[model samples]
Target: MRLPKTAHTSRPWLIHEIAGDFQVEDVWALATPGGPGDLPRLVSQFVSGDFPRGAPLIVRVLWATRWRLGALFGWDRPGAGLGSRVTSLRQRLPESVPPGPGPANLPFTPLYLLADEWAAELANGTVHTVMHVGWVPDGAGGHRGQMAVLVRPNGWFGAAYMAAIKPFRYAFVYPALLKRIERQWHAGTGGAPPLHT
Candidate 1:
């Protein structure tokens, strides 16, 4: 579910050190409740891009439309993406931080990995954005996963693009994505639903 910005800001996530210039565009409490060991499974699922395949019809259509528009406008061309439009976040990371598992299906590049957190980044003409997944205490003696999206717009075009997609993201994309995650989580956990706050 959608969460207040504080849900991300209040946490002392290492991402803050490298993404200070980015804004917290969205924070979500994922429905995948489990112990710490489950973090890898969640991260693996994210990297696999299975969630998008399960998105609602409207969300899928909108995504295809966006991709088509991006191609037509050269918004996501190679020259407009990572290392061209913007340098990879890895360049900004301190040597102490270790790299996370590389993406398998998603377009993002792995940024950093920690015991409870993993981050990846993507860049295009419109924006440089971060996708962060974190394991947080569920306040009932176990832990669950949360996801946050941080963005740094390229310019007026970037800002406008983000604004235009906000409604579709919240109203259609996220809800469907969450339900898919929940369904898969249950499927793996013997069909028991996770506790939701």
Candidate 2:
């Protein structure tokens, strides 16, 4: 379910230090329940999960439409992306966060990774955004994932783009995405995920 911005702002997340200028666009709870040791696997599956092959029809259509529009508008041109249009958030990662290229095959670049948290970033013609995930205690002696999206729009254009898609994101994209994540957590991994430092 969609969570209030405070759900993300109140955490001691390193993203607050790295992207203080960005707005908290959305926060959602991932339903992947497991133990403390499950964080690494959680992050891995999340970044690697395939959302296009068999996602709900609306999701696939949205993905296709988005890519087509980006292609048509030069929204994802190389000049508009990381290290070009804007600086990478990696510049702000403190010593407490590991400085490494995040996992391969994902759309976003990993800013940093800790045992319980991971933050990645992406930039296009429209916006520079951060996707931060944390492993939080479930209050029932287990743990689940929480995701927060932080964004800094390019200008009025960015703001308008965000406003236009807000409803579709909340109504369609997130729920289906989270459901896939929850399903993968329960069925994909054979056992405990390998640890990450």
TM-score of each: 0.91, 0.90
Candidate 1 C-alpha lDDT tens digits along 115-143: 88999888888889988888999898888
Model 2: runs farther than 4 Å from truth? Answer: 100-106, 190-197
lDDT of 1 at 27: 88
Cα-based RMSD of the predictions, in order? 4.5, 4.4
List where candidate 1 sits over 4 angstroms from the true fold. Answer: 189-197
Instruction: Give each model's whole-structure lDDT.
Output: 0.78, 0.76
Candidate 1 positional error at 175, Å: 0.7
Best by lDDT: 1
Candidate 2 residue pairs in backbone clash = none
Cα lDDT tens digits, model 2, 14-132, are 77887999998888888888888777777777566556556689977877788889899998899988999999988876656685335444457878877778887889898998888
Q: Which ten residues in a row have the lowest lDDT in candidate 2?
A: 188-197
Candidate 1: residue 136 Cα off by (Å): 0.2
